[model samples]
Target: MGKRNITDEEIGLIKAMLKRGMRNDEAHFHFNRQDRLISPGRIAQIKSGKYGGDVAIANDTALDQFLAESQQRSGAPAKAARLSGPDWGETFEADGGGGFRVRGGETDTVECKLSFRMNPNRFAEVVKSIAGMANNKGGMIPFRGT
Candidate 1:
């Protein structure tokens, strides 16, 4: 065979995988294991809408169910809030992996603290951030750098 094109069914699975946060290389490996040859770059192009294919829509019901089930199995929340606005709290410095860097920033949705004190006022502010997030459709607080 000279070449084989991806079918609608494969496109659906690929779309589902992408939506589930699977990287292009990961998806390529997944399909290759099943004897379906696909390049990571091609997958990326498909995901980015650069190529034309019958990919599943974002609101696919089956994709949603797959994501929810995967999250449950992984013991993670189905949804998470992103940190918005500016960074707060003290300056933070740490390094992980092969690189190290230091930065201190806060966002509207996040309130970082260098340390937790027994001061009632500080505690109240922390609680206020939590309550604010809860009331404002949820957000994230890294909490004393972790």
Candidate 2:
């Protein structure tokens, strides 16, 4: 079967997801279901500003609703798991299958990274983010493996 073209609405949602610190692969995972497949490269294009310039970002409310509905469709819990204290560690360790969703995307106390390589630029960015978080009550910097 031919790959389905992502709609404007989906593009908007993808923008919102990217804004919320979701990586391209993560956003792609949300849209690329078994019945409707979209190329990962499309998501990379969107992330790199090569696509979806005309589309408006979906609001957090819309994104949240979409996530809830997606969870329901997948038979997962309607509510995303909250990351806090020891529970956060337990959640991560327990969900060996990956793809677990966290409630309340990125916040002042939480930052998400796609990965952490040895490159100086990326390292510096991560350090700056950590310092910023440290300045304000400390925070978690979760790396979503690619």
Using TM-score as the measure, the top candidate is 2
Per-residue CA lDDT of model 2 for 3-54, tens digit only, reads: 4388889999999999999867667767876688788889988877777777
Q: What is the per-residue lDDT of model 1 for residues 10-114, given as tens digits with 9 covering 90 to 100?
A: 667677778878767545533543355566677887787665454555456765675566555534334434433453222234545643232323333345554
What value does the lDDT take at residue 142 in candidate 2?
78
In candidate 1, list every pair of residues with a backbone clash: 84-108, 85-107, 85-108, 86-106, 86-107, 86-108, 87-105, 87-106, 87-107, 88-106
RMSD per candidate (Å) reads: 14.5, 10.2
Question: How well does candidate 1 score on lDDT at residue 89?
Answer: 20
Candidate 1 residue spans exceeding 4 A from truth: 1-4, 33-36, 58-146
Candidate 2's TM-score reads 0.49
